[model samples]
Target: MSVKRLDWPDWLLSTLWLVVIAFIWWMAVRLLHIPEYILPSPEQIVERVSSSPTYFGAATAATLRVIAVGFMAGVAIAIPAGFAFARIQLLEKSLYPFVVFLQTMPLIAVTPVLIIWFGYGLVPTAILVGFSVLFPVLVNTVAAVKNISPRLYFVTSSMGANALQTFRYVDWPMALPYFLSSFRISLALATTTAVVGEFIAANAGLGYLALRGVRNKDPVQVISVVLIAALIGVLLNAASVLVETKVLRKYRD
Candidate 1:
C-alpha cells in the first residue's frame, strides 16, 4: 500500500549524467571551435528556445495531444484482442500472420495511403501512431498469457473458479510483467511515430515546426524543436515507470 515516488538518489544520478553530457558538449564545441551552424552549444540551444517559447509551447501541446490519443486507442484495442487471440487457438492461427505482415510494412509507405483515405489531418496521423504501437503490445501480452502452464488452469478450475475468475486470479497477474514490458517499448514508438505522422501532413505540431525551420534554413529553431521532442519522450518514459511501479509493486517484491 506504500506510494512509490522516484527516489532522490535516482534523481541525483540523472542530474549528474545530464551535467556531464552538457560539459562534454560544451568542451567539444569550445575545443574544436565548431561553427554554430554545424553544432550549437547547449547554452545556445537554451537561448534559442527562450527566444521563441510560445511557438515551441504550442507545437509541444499539439504533439502531446496526438501522442495521448494514439496511445490510449492503441491500449484499448490491443489488450483485449491480444487476450482473445491467446485464448482461442483457431483465431491466433488464422490472424496472427496478418498482424505480423502489417507490422512489418514501413510507415513511410503506409502514410500516403492513409492520408488518401483519412484526409490530411489528425485522423491519419493518430492511426499511424496507433499502428506503430499496436504489435509489440499484442505480441508480448499474448505470448505471456498463452505460455502459462496448463497445470495452473486445472488448479483454478478445481477451486471452482469460472473462466473470468481464472483470468482474474491467475492469467492476468502472470501475464502482467510481459504486458508492461511491451508498454515501455510501445509508448516510445507511439510518440515518435506520431511525430513522423505529423511530418507526413500537418498544419501544426513540432514536426511542422521542424519542417518550417528546415525550409527557412534556421538550425537554431530546428535544434530547439529537437530538444523539446527529446524532453517529451523522457516525460512519457517517466510516466510509464510510475504506472509500472504502482501497479506491480507487490509483484516486484
Candidate 2:
C-alpha cells in the first residue's frame, strides 16, 4: 500500500524553513569558529535584540510613524491624481513628465535637499516615503481607468448618467482593484524609503540604529535591525492584502 502525503499550513512550512536555515547557520558558525563581529549567529542576534528591546522598540515606532504617514498621504494623493491624469489628456501631457522625472530621482539624492528644506525631522522623512509610494499606485490607477471598455461608458451615457455618476458606478469599482493591486508594492516602497530617509536625516529609526551598529562594528546589532525591518515589511504586506480583499468585497457588492 502507498502512504498518503500530508499538506502543511503555509506558516508552518515557512517556520520550518526558517528553523532549518537557522540550524545550518548555527552549525556553520560553530564548525568554522566564526567571530561574532563578522557574522553573528541567529541566537546572538536574538540575544542582542532582547538585551535592548526598548531601544529597538522606540526606533521601530519612529520608523513606523514615517511609514504610516507616508503610505496614507501617498494613497490619498495618488488616487485623485491618477483620476485627473486619466480624465484630462492635456494635464497628463503637461505634468506626467515631471512626475516621471521626480520618480527617476533617487531617494538618497532627494533626502539631502529635503533635509535642507525641512531640516531633519518627521516631515521630510514622511515626504520622502510618500514620494517613494506615489508612482506605482498612480500608474496602476491611470491604467485601470484607461483600460475600461468604451462600451460601458456608452451604456452609462445612454442611460443619461452624468460624468460623476458614471465614475461612481463604473470607474471607481472597476479601477479600485487595479489601484489596490499596487498597495503591496507601495507598502514595500514605504518601508524601504523610510529606512533610507532615516539613514540620511533622522535622529532615531531602525536605519539610524543600523548605522550605529555599523559605527560600532557590531554585526549582531545590524543583523537584528535588518531582521526587524524585514519582519515589518512582511506584516505590512500581509495587512495590505487583507485590506484589499475586504475593500474589494465592499466595492463589488
Candidate 3:
C-alpha cells in the first residue's frame, strides 16, 4: 500500500506567523512607550537600517561572503573525511577522539590564534567560520554512513554492486538527509563565527558597527546592528532550509 503524504502549506503558515510577529512587535512599541536608546521600536530600527543602505549593504555582503565560503569549504572537507573514517575502522578509532576534542575547544579561546595566523582579513574570518562549523558536518556524516543497515549492504553485495557502487547508491542516499541537517546547523554556526571573527578583529562589518555603537554609547545603533545581524542570520538559515527542502523531498515521505 502507498503511504499518504501529508501536505503542509508551509508558505502560508510562515506568512501568517510573520504577520502575527509583526503585529506583536508593533503593539509592544506603541503600547510600552519604550525609549529608543533602551529598546528601539521596530520603526526606529527600520529607519536606521534604511538611512545608510550602502554601508549596511556592503557590511552584510562581506559577512555573507565569509559565511558562504567558509561553510562550503568546511562541508567539502568534512563529508569526504567522514566517509573515510566511517569505512575505515582504524581511521575512525584514531580520529574520532581528536574530532571530539576539537569540538570541545572554545572558539573564543582560539580566535586570537586564528587572527594571528591568518591575519585580520577575510582569510581569518573564513577559517574561523570553517573551524567553528566543521564538527557538525563531520559528526553527522560519519553517523549517517555508519548507520546504514548491514542487511542492505549484504543485499547490494549479492546483487554484484562494487564498493564504489554501494557507496554511491546506498551510503550516499541514506546519508543525504543527515548531511543536509548538518548543513543547516553549519550555516548558522558559520554566520556566528564570522560575526565573532569580525568582533575580534575587523575594520568593517556589522560586528564592527556594533563595537562602534558601544564605544559611542549609542544604544539605538547598537540594537539596530544586532537586529540587522539577527535578520541576516535568519535569512541565511531560511535559504538553507529552502535548499534542504528541495534536495531532501524524496526522503520525506
Best by lDDT: 2
> How does candidate 3 score on lDDT?
0.83
| Model 2 clash number | 0
lDDT of 1: 0.85
Candidate 3: tens digits of C-alpha lDDT, residues 12-103: 77778878987898788779987666666777777887998997888888888888888888888899999999989999999889988988
How many clashes does the backbone of model 1 have?
0
Q: Tens-digit lDDT track for model 2 on 1-253?
A: 9999999986688789989998999999999999988889888888878898999999999999999999999999998999999989999999999999989988788788888898987989999989988999899999999999999999999999998999999999999889778989999999988987888789899999988988988878888988899989988988888899999888767
Candidate number with greatest TM-score: 2
The reply for model 1, stretches above 4 Å from the true place, is 1-8, 250-253
Worst 10 residues of 3 by lDDT: 34-43
**Per-residue alpha-carbon lDDT of model 1 for 98-207, expressed as tens digits?**
99998998988988898778888777778888888789989988999889999999999988999889988798889998888888898889878877778876778888
TM-score winner, 1 or 2:
2
CA lDDT of each prediction against the hidden true structure: 0.85, 0.91, 0.83
Residue runs of model 2 more than 4 Å from their true location after superposition: 1-5
